[model samples]
Target: MDYTALTEAISSKSYEKIAEMCDDLMLQGSTEGVVNNEDWPYAIHLLGHIYVDDINSARFVWKNVPRVVKENRPEVTAAWKIGQRLWTRDYAGVYEAIREFNGSPEAQSLVDSFSEVYTKRMFQLLRSAYSTISIQETALFLGMNEEDATKYVLQQGWSVDPASTMFTVKKQAIVTEQKLDPSKLQRLTEYVFHLEH
Candidate 1:
């Protein structure tokens, strides 16, 4: 099956359609161990994550959640809010919300599910950054030279792209201009490499 195509279709679909698709897939036993399956459930979780981050999208998803998953609806909405705040770098606020949610038995499952989905995303990003094999290619993509690319990677201590192996000259230039620190680059490279094997 063309997973990329499938994911793209899912990503662009309406919240109602996505909910229906999820339900259909689940009925087909396609969601068994979804939390553990990196591709299927992970992709669905990503859709939910995107919805949570995008306000309009989240509302759509919330409106469409099937009755079977209705009990877990609020938690899903909460997860989206938590994720958006977290993505905006509001670590303190995110933590506080997480703490409050964690305290609630009703919210624990959803929170845990969000954590797993988020972790998987991080790993995927790390993998993308590490898989970049050529300094020139990386540099060009970031709009930097080899030296700057190395410096940025070493300094940023985080992976810029963790989903794909390809990087272009323009992207390299962007990375270089961003002036990623050497230490950060090293950390990101190390983390990404560790995942490669």
Candidate 2:
């Protein structure tokens, strides 16, 4: 398989697309015979799944990867480590794994993207779950130092209490308008018309 497009996707940091392509390859049974090597991009594919926070899919990919690839490529192993931490909900361990990764620049970029996405997700979860939370816990969740976490929260409109060292999260109420599917409505109308006739 020509991996030119996959390389371009990695260069552009299109991780979701990478995940889709990897899925399509597996679905087509194209990767079954392919040898794992520098060109196969198994690491990128594995990291792509992890990047999307799809731990189960990531595990699936890891299980199918050739043992030689897993043994030879530290980057691939590191990516799996991150996935393992995610699966166990060890949020701090996730950051530690990323910090310890000394992989190629391409894999490094994906790891960094995953870190940012995970941090944002945790922040959203925290905001929804807490009216006020300790700064220390916020830092742990965000994988940042206390001062940096404080600054990040403040920038997000969370107020800080100097005396208690707590942050008051400003949760925005999300208003979702219901959308109607025209095709579904049309199908229902046609069924009703046939029933009446």
Candidate 3:
């Protein structure tokens, strides 16, 4: 099969589109030709799944990929390392895995996209999981240096203590009450009453 579409998707950095194409390719069969071909750009497909935080799908791709491909393509293995880190929820290891990836220039954008998505995810997790955490820990979670992490937290309206270098995470208050449409509620209530009667 021609790889024109896949190549175009990679060059355009359309990770979502690439992922869809990969899914289609996998559905066709074992992906023997596509996965093993030197020109296949399979690294982008794997990294694109990671970029979208689809760990299970990423694992499927990794499993289907031939051992020879994994051994020969360091970039493909590096991408899987990131997937493994994510699967285990090893937040620190995610950064390490990303740092280890020295993929060709084409795959760098997908890796960078994954880093951005993961950093945002970690920020949300930190806000929900910790009332107060050290700036050092936050830095690790964010894959940023301490100074930059501190600056980022401050920008997010979180308070920081200079002496201890601990940051108080600004948690968004959860609004428990959901607004219901009065007309719909009345209709549902009437229906319930009728059913009961």
Candidate 4:
């Protein structure tokens, strides 16, 4: 039995190496080694994490991985769920998952690494919630000093208020069409074939 591609690696539970192999193989643009293997679920799970910060890449892999691979693979499913929330910038969910994994000594290092992303995502949420909020408040909230928080916000593409140390979020206007009832629609032009005057 040939166990070269993913199964043997997965059976060994050497996920970090599997992730590295997936990267090296993906760079070659030849998926002959990874796809259609019995361990497709595990491979996809590893691939998604390899591009954890890249939401589009993670989703693209998920789409390509197909629905059939998700069956009976709880770990793969959980990994996909994590990638999805990470992609959607769901910091709460991400942090929860990180905390859940933190209990395992083996996974602690990986959890710590993922926590960095959670920290980044928390700030993103903060930036999103406030259209214009005091930088000092942000600094206080994130436990950073004024200057560092200001620099961080600015680096994240938020504008600083000239009058004070405030982070001003520039949100795009949302335009939506009002729904009109069909019965209430006004007919501006109508041709009368036969009208009783």
Which candidate achieves the best lDDT against the true structure? Answer: 2
Residues 1-197, model 3: lDDT tens digits? 55678778878877778777877765553445444345455687788788777888889888878777888988999989999999998888999999888988878778887788789889999999999999999999998899999988899999998898889889988989988999999999999999999
**Model 4 weakest 10-residue run by lDDT:** 188-197
Residue pairs with backbone overlap in model 4:
none
Q: What is candidate 2's CA lDDT for residue 38?
A: 47
| Candidate 4 residue-pair clash tally | 0
Candidate 2 clash total? Answer: 0
Residue-wise C-alpha lDDT for candidate 4, range 1-197, written one tens digit per residue: 23376555555555445555555555444445434544443434444254356556556656665566667555555556667667765545655555554222323444455556556665866756878889777775544678987887787778987688677875645799999866555332222322422
Worst 10 residues of 2 by lDDT: 30-39
- Per-residue lDDT for 105-183 in model 2, tens only? 8888888888888899999999999999999999999999999999999999999999999999999879999899999
Better of 2 and 4 by TM-score: 2
TM-score: model 2 vs. ground truth: 0.83
lDDT of 1 by residue, 47-113 (tens): 4444344435444444555554545445544555565565575544554555455323423544554
Q: Which of the two, 1 or 3, has more lDDT? A: 3
Could you tell me the TM-score of candidate 4? Answer: 0.43
lDDT score, candidate 4, position 98 = 50
